[model samples]
Target: MKATNEIKPRLDVVSRAITSIVEGVCKENDFDIQYSGIESTDGLPVRQLPAIWDALKTAKARMNHQMNQLISRITHRWNLASSIHRLPAEVLAIIFQEFEPIPGHPDGDSSLLNLLLVLRAWYDAITGSPQLWRSFGAHTPYNIARLVVDHSKALPISVDWRPPREPPKRDLGKVLDLAIENSARVKSLTASVPHEGDPHL
Candidate 1:
């Protein structure tokens, strides 16, 4: 029947009540139990042990559940009132753009993808902005490239399709082929090939 805010104050009262009941039972049984030796105590009757253990366990579980609920409520309220959450979606989109990694970085796509996991608002803002998906790096995978092209929604795109320095005989033609397929929407392109003298070429 009480509100969530009132539950915190009641925790202390519940704790004290449990302590008083425990101490009363110990006193009535004339048991001089030490904290570490509770399990070894033979002075307390076996019938009372189960009741005492069950009461402690139930109290611990209930208090733990309440604590978790309170923490979740606090976090939810804090996020709702946070400045970043208050920003307009356009502003958030610009912020996401600023978080974009420099081209050629091996973790560029993964780093940008992390921004999408931050919050629902951020995910919506980034996904709704076509400009964010208009750039592709050499390290970008073909499937991800396709996703970006689709999300770009007819907007001009930039591609950086540079071959790695050392040749492992790996074929990059598929990546380039996809890039070429999207060439109509290409605004800027950077390509690198092995030097003519290089045997890997």
Candidate 2:
């Protein structure tokens, strides 16, 4: 993802520059053909036709950038046709839940999320699985957190905000809102309060 984020903009810049040059060359070629009044290459000055042909060939080669796109499309199709897609949706959902750690656990395996990302074809199965969305963490934004809670299908959930930096100096009001709102369904709760300077415990 880091490489992708960096390389994509550079590729876009190069593609745009090449497209501009190609358009300019095309305009020049069209006007020259009209101005020459030659019905065919046979009537053109000696050697000029060969030079034009060479330039056209060079332009075509410069446009070989499309070859990368062709390869990408081929790989994309290959991934889409992978045998893993043949698994039933229920099986996929179960497998994802097996690999995914309890939501909002202190030592959850973050890398498992990366594994799920690689299996792009199984997005529906993963998101549709209620077991995978049963955790709430302070790091999740409010909007997405709401959706995650909603996706849990009213199952009792663990609420965790135990990271030291959470709640920004451990403001209890800010950190406990969601847990309070969903108190009925919150089965386990953990939080951290920075008590370094507080006179009151």
The Cα local distance difference test for each model comes to: 0.71, 0.63
* TM-scores of the models, in the order given: 0.62, 0.55
Worst 10 residues of 2 by lDDT: 31-40
Error of 2 at 125 (Å): 1.2
**lDDT string, candidate 1, 1-201, tens digits:** 888566555666765665665665565555545432334445667877776666667767887898899988988788878899999999987877876644553545456678888777788888888878877756676677777888889899888766555452233666678788988888887777767888656
Report the C-alpha lDDT of model 2 over 1-201, residue by residue, as the tens digit.
487336555766766665555445545555233222224335445655565566667877866767778878888888878888878778987777766644563356544356556756677676677777777676554654575577778788888766533333344444468667888988887777747874433
How good is model 1 by TM-score? Answer: 0.62
Error of 2 at 95 (Å): 2.2
Candidate 2, which segments miss by more than 4 Å at Cα? Answer: 1-69, 101-106, 139-144, 163-175, 191-201
Number of backbone collisions per candidate: 0, 0
Off by over 4 Å in 1: 1-66, 105-110, 165-174, 196-201
Error of 2 at 142 (Å): 3.5
